[model samples]
Target: MPLALYMLGLAVFAQGTSEFMLSGLVPDIAADLQVSLPVAGTLTSVFALGMVVGAPLTAVVGLRWCRRRALLSFLAAFVLAHVVGAITTSFGVLLATRAVGALANAGFLAVGLATAAGMVEANAKGRATSVLLGGVTLACVAGVPAGALLGQLLGWRSAFWAVALVSVPAFHAILRWVPATTSAATGRGAGPSGAGASGASGASGARAGDFRARRELRALRRPRLLVLLALGALVNGATFCTFTYLAPLVTGPAGLAEAWVPVVLALFGIGSFAGVTIAGRLSDARPMRLLVPGGLALLVGWLLFPAVVDHAIAVFALVLVQGALSFAVGSTLIARVLYEAVEAPSLGGAFATAAFNVGAAVGPSLGGAAIGAGLGHRAPLSVSALLVAAAFGTAGLALAVRRVRARRGEPAGRTLTS
Candidate 1:
């Protein structure tokens, strides 16, 4: 992978902690700000909501700026939000900062995806994406738990302060490594050039910009791309249903002690890290090789999860396998979205980001609804199975349609480039 990718990944590690760290800080935040725990928990949801809105909005707005400028501006805003959040006494201000920080984080992720892909060869896009997205898993594995520890030892405010401070090196790495020609106006595989490389001028440039914007917007309407986005969402939602209520499920039905929760969580993260690492190397070469079997196995795994939910050993084995399979399939779907959106590279990143955020919101809602209905821990597992089945139907439909298109002698992977 390119140095730029590592920088972007590092940047994500810095910002991504803010997303999950709040799960551990809710009690502290609620007590300190004198808000209810439910209200404090809403901060995390607010961030997801902001990302869903911000991804595409920021992509369109950032199209004219060079990558460094756009990424740095977003990063600076994110750090500043943390600074304010750390010092603020009001719950309302903390909520607002979470939203602002999420918006910035969304922009950074969207840009980072596009940049990572553009920095590599066509055949290496999968690896590039994996390298960049690997930071997210690492954040889950190390950053979140570490933040929880920080909040436990000092205060919740310390976690916010730590996130901002950690970004300082990422800031420097990006400044030194990212190229100047990395903007929407520039095509893929450009080397570092003069700062003015993306500087367009006059009526012709304006017309071209308008045309590009229209193309990006139109990319969203493609049938195949839309299906892939939906597939991404369903698969992600399935995983979240399992992930969101993991601790309760462990203790409630699996009969695990409270101490075993973190062990199980860490195992899942480690499995996910392995999945992303291996899948990235191979997804670009033969996506279906991983996707078809991986998807099917995941579908089967979820179907079997409920039966095994009560057995501690079974749950452990199931969680480990599901984590690996989920991320394998999920990463492939992510890469596929970018592959199909060849016409709108920048917009493709935003689309992928928004799709996953949509899943993040949907999965939690479904799981929450199941629990509210008195479905117990097993309810989430059942919903997860249903979600996986929906994902299979989604992929099968996409494949069937593409096969039909192929029979008609149309090209593949274009989706909407025409």
Candidate 2:
């Protein structure tokens, strides 16, 4: 992998930390802002909504600039938003900052994935994307917990300040290490080298950005691809539905002390880190292997959460397992989307980001509604289980379709399973 790939991962870590830390700070934010808990939960939904809206919005605008330039521009805006968020006293202002920052975040990720995929050999795209996404999982491992601790000690606003400060170094890293040519913006592959295949590598490089934005949009309408997008939404929605309220869940039904919340979160982070890394290594050759088991694990974990909430040890262990299961197949899902839209890698990447945030928005909103309805803290997990089961059904339908095509001797676009 290129140094740019690692740097992209670092960039993801910085932005992702800012995104995930809000979960732990929801209670503090509610108290400090004099808002109700359900209202504070909307912060997560708002950020996700920004991501869904910002991805294509930025993709169209960013097409004029190279990937490196666009990434830097987005990061600058993201950092600025955090700075504003850190200082803002009004909840409305704070929410506006999250929306603006999410726009930047979505754009950066979409461009960054396209750039990373272009920077490597054809066979290495999966690993490159995994490394990039690993940064997000790593944020879970270190950044989120530390931010939660900072919020616990200093205040929720201090966490935003820390995010702002940490992002500065990432900005420098991208400017220094990521090259200017690392974009598919002008229908030219930009990177250190082309994808390894000789004949199929397009005029400039990979089969990236060859299609116009309109064609890319059209390609995304494929039935299987739509199912994949829905799958991404469901997977992420299930994860966040429970995750956004994790602090309270642990403190209440899980019977853990408030002091132990961060520790448990750290454990969840560790599981996520391992799951992403492992899933990444398998993504290129055995995506279904990861997806099937990972989805099943998610279903099982969510189902178990409601039953085991009163058992402290059981809940702690479940949190770790659930975290791992939630994120383990992420790279596989991303790889599937890229494969499904190989002709329009950047748009494909943008769609992947959008699908995720769509779920991000849906999950928290439903969870918050459940909480608002006077359902117990455990309601989120039940909601999560139903969502995961739906995702699993979608995946099953996809597999069944693949089998039907195989029987008819029709070509399956890209082979996900051997």
By lDDT, the best candidate is 1
Q: CA shift at 386, candidate 2, in angstroms?
A: 1.9
**How well does candidate 2 score on lDDT at residue 137?**
83
Q: What is the TM-score of each candidate against the true structure?
A: 0.93, 0.85
| Candidate closest to the true structure, highest TM-score | 1
Question: What lDDT does each candidate get?
Answer: 0.83, 0.80
For model 2, the stretches where C-alpha displacement exceeds 4 angstroms are 24-42, 88-92, 152-155, 185-211, 371-375, 401-412
Q: Each model's RMSD to truth, in Å? A: 2.7, 4.9
Clashes of 2: 0
lDDT score for candidate 1 against the true structure: 0.83
Backbone clash count, each prediction separately: 0, 0
lDDT of 2 at 163: 80
Summarize candidate 1's per-residue lDDT along 1-418 as a digit string, tens digits. 7676887898788777788788889998899989898888899999999999999888876676777777888899999999999999988999999999999999989888888877788777788888877887778788889999999999999999999998777788778877656666345644453234455556644555566668788977888888888988998898888888999999898898999988888778877777888889888888888888898899899889888787888888888888888888888788888777777887898889999889988998999899999989878888988998998887677778788879998875543222
Pairs in clash, predicted candidate 1: none
lDDT of 2 at 198: 17
Give the TM-score (vs. native) of candidate 2: 0.85
Report the lDDT of model 2 for residue 141.
Answer: 84
Q: Which window of 10 residues has the lowest lDDT sum in candidate 1?
A: 189-198
